[model samples]
Target chain A: MSITIYVPADAAALALGADAVAAAITREAARRGMDIRLVRNGSRGMFWLEPLVEVATARGRMAYGPVAAGDVCGLFDADFAGGGVHPLLLGFTEDLSWLRQQRRLACRRIGVIDPRSLADYKAHGGGEGLRRSRSLAPAEIVSAVTASGLRGRGGAAFPTGIKWKTVLDTAASQKYIVCNADEGDSGTFSDRLLMEGDPFQLLEGMAIAGLAVGATQGYIYVRSEYPHAIEALNRAIEGARDWLGNGPGKFTIEVRKGAGSYVCGEETAMLESIEGRRGIVRAKPPLPAISGLFGQPTVINNVITFASVPDIFAQGADIYSGMGCNRSRGTLPFQLAGNIRFGGLVEVPFGLKLRDLLYDFGGGSRSGRPLRAVQVGGPLGAYLPESQFNTVLDYEAFAAIGAGLGHGGIVAFDDTVDMAKQARYAMKFCAIESCGKCTPCRIGSTRGVEVIDRIGAGQAGQIALLRELCDTMTHGSLCAMGSMTPYPVLSALNHFPEDFA
Target chain B: MENLPAIERTIEAIVAAKQSLPGALLPILHEIQDGLGYIPSESVPRIAKALNLSRAEVHGVITYYQHFRQIPPGRHVLRVCCAEACQAVGGEALAEHARLRLQGSDLTLEPVYCLGLCACGPALQIDETTLHARVTPQKFDALVDALEVDP
Candidate 1:
């Protein structure tokens, strides 16, 4: 019998040259005249030991890791090829301390199963939601979702069931269900990881959305940077597509690749990209609920939003909703990133204190420096000082602290990051990524950059100019780019005024 | 622009959606962008055609949303997360590396808001690969080494 090995295709593994390491293992095994079956799986977090490869012996999937392509020689020399045990070989990857600590609900089969394998998926709770959907009425499905307290994971805390209700109520000949796979924020790879590692789950979630809104056509608007994810998803779509043809498969969700404009993460812009045009936001009077993709009612939801729905239906809304804090019910998939230790994907029940996430789960900064400022959300998110460390992760809790639970990402800094420079960079980000559709976003952003620069340079009238810029953008701009760009700028000023000059 | 009939139809949908939107810049922008993929520079007409509003009004709304783009993005999109969580390490360095690597290529690297994976620092996304912690140029190189144009 041939030996079976699994390597994580997670970014960390790929970054650690796991691809190369796997190739090396195959090459070395072949050189020894042994047959080896290599499987590239998803990351189980435990990022510290990436390029983490699993070798199947009589025992289980033994893990050996943080291995680089260059490590092949030593690995083979150490008797690793013949199932020779090495120090790196941790037994039964599932039981690893880091992964074991997590309460993986949505990510149950993420790194374990083959992403595109429907059979593997079905065996591991794959199409159960759709199968469940087949049995329930559309209204029943929507109510189950509503009761689950599942809100949009893409930053906004909007409820998913109501979004469906809007489309379901609207009169339209054609309605589209759009899956927002554009995980554009930094530190947050939950959506991307789910798309790449457990694509079928996302597809199931999308199909559920389609059936809820009576939409025949569905679109999975994914960002362009993830070539591997695109490949994985396209393959998964094909694999799942056949399951739909016999009578009705609930809905057919099309995976449309985005060229990577940050704007495409925005749903309307995503729609724009799917239709094959420049990526820009549009005004709304007739929300996508009434008039959306193809001039029909459309329901747009984040990848996590859709992925979470399956659990709501499969496990029952109360069962899923019973986990988190009030309002923000259920578990959340958060990314523990940046200069922090113990960084990876974390799925914890809501209501956990920020301190618990940072120190207890994250284990503090990897830089070994004292914690300084933390920026939640993406570039547009605010930078909170240590004072707000106790803030809960729910939607209202963050808002109370003048912060936002925009995409559950947590970045840590150890007393060294220059907030002033960060503020200037925020405006610069807007200036570069701006669609140039509005004066406040286009011009005010550039002006904001100049003003932040002036403040950073210790110039006079800095505070006044900064305040003026914030007001101009917030009041004058049509969207969050111009409006929320001030979040970083103001938060930086409030949290780290000393950083400015 | 008309060469993309589906795109034209999507633009029409966006304009129609805007009329009944909650007047929230983001939700509206979300709808329009959803309809057309990328907001077209000439989407004013499609918006006018569908929404029965002036081109200036549609343009006004598009300009207000940060997520909307007036110009076309590249065929391949590369987004790097520059959030606080990512910045603790060398996220800025990684961002610079991406900019440099994609400089001569058709790739467009831009900073994104929070993708929700905060625990994974220095996250870089090439389409949908939400790379978690320990993102360096070498790792980025390996990830893109086998990347080819999508058919």
Candidate 2:
């Protein structure tokens, strides 16, 4: 019998030298004349233990990780293929407290299966949602999704069903499904993880969306930064051709790569970029549901938003809706990043307190210094102080405190950070990334940097000027780029006044 | 200047292949950049003509995206993450180290907002193919040394 060994091929895992570890394992297996089936699976979101090598044992998948190429020789000596005890051993992969605590509804298949294998994906309850959708009417499918209470995971938090219903109601000979995979948010990687890990699920979700909304053609606008995800999605589309386009509805999916533009993550900007224009945000009177993508009713959703659809159909809607609190239903895949220890993905119900996620799962700052501030959502999110650490992760809870759980990315910063510098960066980033169509974002951002500089130089009156500028940018700007730039700047000013002084 | 015609031919072939794609400009630009280190300024007219758009429209798009460079890059492209996540973990210092190290070298160093390695940052990419996480000044030097030795 051949022994099975798992190695993660996730971009993060690869960045951490998983390839070298896998090569060393293969070389050792070949030299020892041992039969071994090495599977390059997706990451299980436990990044600190990456290049997390797992072997299928009589018990379960025994894990060893943070492994290096040099450790492979000693591993072979210890009969690691037979689940031998090694110093790097982490016991069972599931038994890890970090993974065991959370609810992983949408991300269930991520690190568990071979991403390239359709057979493996199907075996692990992959196509059940699409299968269920195939038997239902368009309206019925829409109702199921609406009942599931799934909202857009793309920071906007718009109800997925309402968006779908509008598209379904809108009369169009040509409807389109656009998956927003252009996740340029600084602290977010859930979109990349899902697209690279279980691409078929996203495809399935898109197909179901097409069936529900009367859209036949779909486009996944992926960022150029995520080359691994693009390759995985392209491969998945090719492999799942029989199931996707051959049916009566005839759904076909195309993967489109984005240029390096942060504004392109915006739906209107994404639509413009898809049409081969500058990623300028369009004013939203004729919301995307009415006139989108070549002047047709298009269902534009984030990668995770679409990825969450399949499970809603596979399991009953109540199962998903029952988990989360308030209007925010289902699990959100929270990415713990930056200066935090045990940094990885955690999918849980919406109401998990921010402190628990920061300290309990993250284990505090990597530098062992007191964590001073945490930025949730993305670059556009607020720079939350330690005082607000007790706030829950729900959308309403965050919104109540003038913050957002945008894409569920929490970037931690230790006491070494300068909040004033961070605030300046927010303005600087806006200046660099703004689409130039809007004035408040384009000119105000540049002015913001100058104001911050003056304030930092002990120009006392500039603080009032900066606040006035933020107010103008907040109200006068066309899109979130200009409008939400104030979130970080204001939050920093409000929370950490000493940094400015 | 010697490879001007060859560059034109490459751009022509790329535009011809990808012109029919929906919102074909980005895809064509990506291919041209991938094939050639940068999208040549002269190739803009050809792309504009092929895509049936005005030269200014094409030029505007080319310049709008930071990815589409007008001039050719160095022998290697090094993108260091300068985003909030990476910045939280001394990414700014790593970027500074990269800048000082590659000042007069045959390497082009650019600031990327994020590389999705937020957890294990400070992250960087070499030539857009290889990504490195938790990169310190010392580790960055070693990686650069390896690149220099090989290239």
Using DockQ as the measure, which candidate wins? 2
lDDT string, candidate 1, A344-431, tens digits: 7788888888888888888888889988888788777888899999998788898887778787876677888888888888888888
Kindly list the per-residue Cα lDDT of model 2 for residues A311-407, writing each as its tens digit: 8888889877898888888899999999998899999998889999999999999999999999999999999999999998899999999999999
In model 1, what lDDT does residue B39 have?
A: 75
lDDT (tens digit, per residue) of candidate 2 on B1-151: 8988998899889989988887899999999999998988887899899889999999999999988898889889999999999999999999999999998998899999888999999999988889899999999999999888886
Model 2 complex DockQ against the native: 0.90
Highest TM-score against the true fold, candidate:
2
Candidate 1 residue lDDT tens string, B56-141: 76676566444467766675566776755666677778888888887777666767654444555566665444444456789776
* DockQ, prediction 1: 0.24
Report the TM-score of candidate 2, chain B only: 0.96
The predictions' CA RMSDs to the true structure, in order, are 7.3, 0.9
Q: Classify candidate 2 by CAPRI docking class.
A: high
Query: What's the DockQ for every one of the candidates?
Result: 0.24, 0.90
* Cα distance off (Å), candidate 2, residue A445: 0.7
